[model samples]
Target: MKQFAMLIYPGFTALDLIGPQTVFSTFRDAKIHLVWKTLDPVTTDAGITLLPTASFDTCPEELEILFVPGGVEGTIAVMKDGEVLDFLAARAEQASYVTSVCTGSLVLGAAGLLRGYRATTHWAFREMLPLLGAEPVDARYVEDRNRITGGGVTSGIDFGLRIDAKLQGEEAAQLA
Candidate 1:
C-alpha cells in the first residue's frame, strides 16, 4: 500500500483536507492517515470536527507523501508551532513527497522546508512566501523537486490528482 500521512490540527480548513483526500480515496491501494499531535477530535475553522486516525507518535516512519492542510488562524499558529514544524522537517526528509495547500505552505516554510524552493499558496498569502526564502509563483500549484504546494482550498483537488499521476500514471490520474 502507498502510505500517506495527512496532518490535521485544530482549526484546519475542512475543504483543504477533504478535497485532496477525495482524490486519494479513489485509489484502492492507498492508505490515508489522518494524523495529529494525538488521536483526538480536531475541530475545523468551519466548526466541524474530525477524528484523527493516528498521532505523530504512531504515524508510519516513512510515507509516500506528507500532507498539510490549511486555515488562516491555524496556519498562523502552526507557523509558530515548534513541535509540529520540527516533526514535519524530520518526516519530510524520509518521505517521498512533501506538500501543503493554501497557507499550509507557510507552515512548511516555518519548518524550513521551502527555502530556495519555488512554491505557491493561497493568493492572498503568496506575498508571504518570500519571507520564508521561497520563490512565490502565481500558479494554482507549484512543484519544485519533491516539494509541492497548492493554491487555495478548492485547488487541492487538482493538486491531489497531479500527485496521483506522478505516483501512479496518467491513466490512473485520469481514472481518478
Candidate 2:
C-alpha cells in the first residue's frame, strides 16, 4: 500500500486539504497521514480547524507521496522558514512525487524544488513565483514530471485527480 503524507500548516486553505483528503481517503489500501507543525488543532483559512494525525518530527520516514497545501500564512511561512524548507527538501528527495496546491507552490519554490521548473500557484501569487526562481505556467493545474501544482483553492482536487491517474492508473483515478 502507498503511504501519503499531507502537510498542513496554520491558516492553510480548507479546500486545498479537504479536496485531496476526500479523494485519496476513498482508497482503502492507501494510508493518508496528516502532518502538521504541532498536534494541536490548526485553523484553516476558512475558519475550520483539524486535528493533525502527526507532527513534523513524528511523520513516517517513508512517504510515497507528499501533498503541500497553501494558505495566506503559507505565503509568508514557507518563504522564510528554514526548518520547514529543510524538512520538505529532504523528504522530497525520497518521496515518489512532491506536489503543491495554490500558493503551496510558493512553499515548494522556497524549498528549492521548483528551480528551473514551470509551475502554477494561486492567481494572487502567480507573479511572485519568480522570486523562487520558477516560471509561472498560469494553468489551473500544471504537471511537470514528478511535480504537480494547482491554482487557487478549488484546483487542488483536479491536481489530486491528475496525480491519482499518474500514480494509480486511469481506472484507479477515475474510481477516485
| TM-score versus the correct structure, for each prediction | 0.98, 0.93
Candidate 2, 1-176: lDDT as tens digits: 88888987777888988898888886767889888778999788788988989888988777788889998865586568888888888789888888989888899998999988889999988998898989899899997878888999898888888877877788988898
| Index of the highest-TM-score prediction | 1
Model 1 gets an lDDT of: 0.92
Those runs of model 1 whose alpha carbons end farther than 4 Å from true positions after fitting are none
Q: Write the per-residue lDDT of candidate 1 for residues 18-65, one digit (tens) a residue.
A: 999998998878799999999879999999999999888898878999
Report the CA-based lDDT of candidate 2 relative to the real structure: 0.85
